[model samples]
Target: MKSPVRVMLIIILIILVVAGGTVATAMYLKHHRHQAATAATATHQLSAKEAAALQVSLPQMTTNLQTSGLIQFTVTLQADKKATKNELTLMQSQIEDSINQIMRQYTPDQLRNDKGLNSLKQTILKSVNHMLPTGSVTNIYFSQVLVQ
Candidate 1:
C-alpha cells in the first residue's frame, strides 16, 4: 500500500510529464509550419518586371531536314505582354513558314550539336520577330526536338 502523499506526488509528476510532451509537440508543429510557409513564399514570390512577361507555346512542327531525315519539335515563344492573342494567332501561319524554312537549312549533324542548336534557335527567333508586325519575340525555347 502506497502512502497518500506519495500517490499524489506520482500523479503530479505524470501530469507534468504529459504537459511537457504536449508543449513540445505544439512547438514542433509551429516551427515546421513556419518553415513550410517561408519556403512557399520564397518559391512563389514574383517581381513586378517578371509579372509583365508572357509565354506562348507554338504548335508542334514536323518538317523534312536538308539531309535524308525528318525533324519534329515543339517551340515556346517568350515575348512581352503587349503581344495580344489575336496578333499571335494572325501570325501563326507566317511563323510556321519561317520556322520551316529555317529547319530546312539545318542537317541532322548540325541539329545534334549544342552550338548548332543555339544557332538554329537564334535564326528562328530572328525570323519570327521579323515577321511579327505587332510585337517582337524576346526568346525562343525548343521544348522538344527530335532529329531522325
Candidate 2:
C-alpha cells in the first residue's frame, strides 16, 4: 500500500511538471509571436487611402548597371505622412541621384531575381529613410522594373 501510494505521487508529480512546462512554452511562443506580428504589421499594414495620400511617384529612370546592361524602372515611395511625401517631392532630384547611385552598384543579373529586387528595395528604403529629416519612408514600390 505504501509503495503504491509513493508511485502514484511520483507519477502525478511528473505529469504536473510536464504539463507546466508545456503550458509555459506555449504561452512564451504565443506572446512572442503576437509581438512579432504586431511589429511587422505596424511597419507594413496601411489603408489604401493612407497609402495613396502618402505616396510619391518618381518618373521613369534609365541607367546603366555596374557590369553591363541597361535598367529602367519607376519607383513609388510611401512616406510616413503627407509632409514626408511633400518633402520627397521637393527632394526628387536628390532621391533620383540616390536611386541612380544605388542602381549603378548592382548588375542586371542582380536585379533580375526576386531576392535581388527585394534587396535593392530594402537598401533604397533604408537609404532614403536615413536621408529624411522631418519624416521617414514607410515602404518602397517599383511600379516597373526592366533590366536588359
Candidate 3:
C-alpha cells in the first residue's frame, strides 16, 4: 500500500511539471507573436503616412561622382498635398536643378552606402523645400539607382 501511494504522488508531480512547462511555453510564444505584430503594424502605419503625402517623380539625371564613377538615379519627391499641380509644375525645373546640384556633391562610394543615401535624401529635401513657398517636400524616394 505504501509503495502504491508513493508511485501515484510521483506520477502526479511529473504531470504537474509538464503542464506548467507547456503553459509557460505557450505564453512566451503568444507574447513574442504580439510584439512582432505590433512592429509590423507600426511599419504599415509609417507607409500609410508616406502614401498620404503627394508624390512627384523627378526626371532621371546622371552626374559624375567627385572621384571616378558616374551615378544615375530616378528620384521621387513627396511634397505637401496643399501644393497645387500648377505650382509644382512651374517649379519642376528648379527642383530638378537643385537635386542635380546636390547629387554632384556626393561621391559614387558615398551614394552606395545607407548613410550616404540618407544624407543625400536630407540634402535634396531641404534644398527642394527652400525652393518652394507653398508646399514643402516631406520625403525623397529613389525609384531607381545606378552607380557605375
Candidate 4:
C-alpha cells in the first residue's frame, strides 16, 4: 500500500504539471494572436482603384526654400475614407497653403534625401488631418520632387 505522504506528493506534482501546461498554452496563444495581427497589417496593400477613390492629388507646386533655392513637387494625399477625400478636395486651397508654409520652413538641402522627404510627408499628413473636421489623412505621396 502507498504511504499518505507519497500519495499527496504525487497529487501535488500532477497539479503543478497541469497548471504549468495551461499557463504556457495561454501565453503561446496570446503571442501567436498578436503576431498574426501584426503580420496581417504589414501584408495589407491597397489596390489602385481603392487608392484612387481615397486619394486627393494636388497640382504641381513651386515654392522658395527658407534661405535660397526653389522646390517643386506634386503631392498626393491619401485619406482614410471617401468623405475625407471629398473634404480634402473642398479644402484644397487651405491644404496648398499649409504645404507652402511647411515648404518654406525647410531648406533645399533638407528635402534632398528620403529621410527628409519622409519627414516632410509626415508633417503634411499631421497638418492636413488637423484641418479636417472628420476622418483623417493616412499618407502623403510626392510624385515629383525637384529641388534646385
> Quick one: how many clashes does candidate 2 have?
0
List runs of model 1 lying over 4 Å from the truth.
1-53
Candidate 1 lDDT, tens digit per residue, 1-148?
5699899999999999999999999999999999999999658744556643566678899999998999999987766555543466677787888899999998999999899999999998888777777767767889899999
Go through the candidates in order and give the clash count of each: 0, 0, 0, 0
Query: What stretches of model 3 exceed 4 Å from their correct place?
Result: 1-53
What TM-score fits each model? 0.62, 0.71, 0.62, 0.71
Better of 1 and 3 by TM-score: 3
lDDT of 2: 0.93
Question: Which regions in candidate 2 have their CA more than 4 angstroms from the true location?
Answer: 1-44
Query: Of the pair 2 and 3, which is ahead by TM-score?
Result: 2
Candidate with best lDDT? 4
Candidate 3 C-alpha lDDT tens digits along 1-148: 9999999999999999999999999999999999999999656533565554556777889888777888889988765564543466678988887777787888988988899999999988888777777767667899899998
Ranking 2 against 3 by lDDT, winner: 2
- Which rank order by TM-score, best down to worst? 4, 2, 3, 1
What lDDT does each candidate get? 0.83, 0.93, 0.80, 0.94
Q: How should the candidates be ordered by lDDT, best one leading?
A: 4, 2, 1, 3
Q: Which ten residues in a row have the lowest lDDT in candidate 3?
A: 44-53
Candidate 1: give the clashing pairs: none
